[model samples]
Structures are given as structure tokens and as C-alpha cells.
Target: MTRSSIRTSLLALCAAAVCTVASAKLPAPSPEAAAKAAEAAAKAAWAGKVDNYKLCLSQDKVAAHYRKTTPSANPAAAGGAACADPGPFAYTPPAAKPAEAAGAHSPPGTASSPPSTQVPAAAAAPASKS
Candidate 1:
């Protein structure tokens, strides 16, 4: 087992492991799990917005401090867009409709209406001579 051969063997093993991992299929998440994941994603997005807002505020503060301390040739040109603040984090999960309310099935006790009596257009049309 020379050094080069051992390194080659290790590389091959690593490649095989990577390929195996890449091809693996994870089981689908349950409904509850999916809902949680969605909520987590929303929270993460809100967190990102909050982070950006904080960064913007810090940058603005820094810029203001720099302007106050340093004399610039043009003082009037210091105007820039105001920093936007992401006020708060609010995650409202989408309202779930009950099976009946979602129109999954006809209302509880009511009988289904009879089939339509009108003939379909295709069948009613006159046949072509050709």
C-alpha cells in the first residue's frame, strides 16, 4: 500500500459515498411537519428582514457619525434615502379549511342533483358530408 495508491483508494471511497448520498431519497414530510417547516421558513425570512433593517440602521449611524466628524467639501450633498425599518416579526399560519368547507364533498344530508338533461354540443352538431 504505497502513499499514492492509498490516497487514490480514499478518493474513490469518498466519491462513492458522495454519489450514494446524492441519490438517496428522503421520505415525504407529514402534514404537521410540512406546516412546521413552512412556519420555520416564514420566521427565517422575517429574521433576514430584521437583520437587514438592523444593518441598515447601523450603516446609517456610521455614515451620520462620519459626516459629523469629517468636514466634506460639499455639505449639502449628504442627503440619501432613509433607512427602512422592519417593525416587527409576525407569522400567521394560513387558515385551514375543514373538509366540508373546502368543498371536498356535497353538504351533509342533501341529495346530489340529477344529471343535466341537455345534450352535449358535439353530439348535437350535424355530421359533415366529407
Candidate 2:
């Protein structure tokens, strides 16, 4: 390559490096930016708790099982157990999966065959000693 072209490339690289360093030296976030970030973090934390709350509510059987097993001494187990799910809240039931049709269960040619009910003679005998 020509000397002029090499010089131009080196200058371009130096400019990019300077720009990156200047950006890295930027001042800390403004008060408004900090406040906005704090608010967003609070919302995220609340969302996580809300999700866990919903999960706890949906796990009625788990809560019941814990309540059944947990002793009366350690009372903290009641969070996901006895009565700490959610209260006075609207609950939307989960959507149901579509059921497979009865005809789709077996191949057409084998659908009418009777199932084998007899045990094999070898399997019927107990294992012999070596």
C-alpha cells in the first residue's frame, strides 16, 4: 500500500481510540438518570416477587403437602405452605392442552389386533443358580 494510505489508516485508528477513552471518562449518571434506574430496578424486583407469588398460589398441592409435613415449631414454612400464597386477588386459570383423538392412538392395520396376555415360558421360571 502507499504511504499516504497507511498514514490515513493510522490516523483513523487513533481517532477511534481517543473517542473511546473520552467516553470512558464520562461523569457519573445525573440524579434523574439515577432515579429512573432505581425505579426500573424496583419494578423488576416487584415483578419477580409477583411471579413467585403467582407460582406459590398455583401450587396448592405443594402448599398442602408442606403444611402436612412441617411441624408446628418452625412457623416460617407457612410462606409457601399453609396460608401465605396470595389473598383477595384475581386468578386466571391456565389454558388447557388439546386432547389427542382416539383414532390417532394406533395404526389402522394394527388397531384390531388383540393384546398378548400370556407370559413367556422362560420368563415364568425362576433364575437358576450358576
What are the models' TM-scores?
A: 0.59, 0.33
Find the 10 residues in a row with the least total lDDT in model 1. Answer: 108-117
Candidate 1: misplaced stretches above 4 Å?
1-18, 97-130
- State in Å the error of residue 62, model 1: 1.5
**Model 2, which residues run further than 4 Å from truth?**
1-23, 61-130
Candidate 2: residue 102 lDDT (0-100): 47
Number of colliding residue pairs in model 2: 0
lDDT of 2 by residue, 55-98 (tens): 76668666667767877635565554442433333433334344
Which lDDT value does model 1 have at 54? 87
Task: Please report the candidate that would top TM-score against the real structure.
Answer: 1
Measured by lDDT, the strongest candidate is: 1
- Writing each residue's lDDT as its tens digit, candidate 1 over 1-130 gives 9999999999999999999999999999998999999999998988888898889889878877887888763557668887777777777889989988988887556658655648877687868888
Model 2 lDDT at residue 83: 28
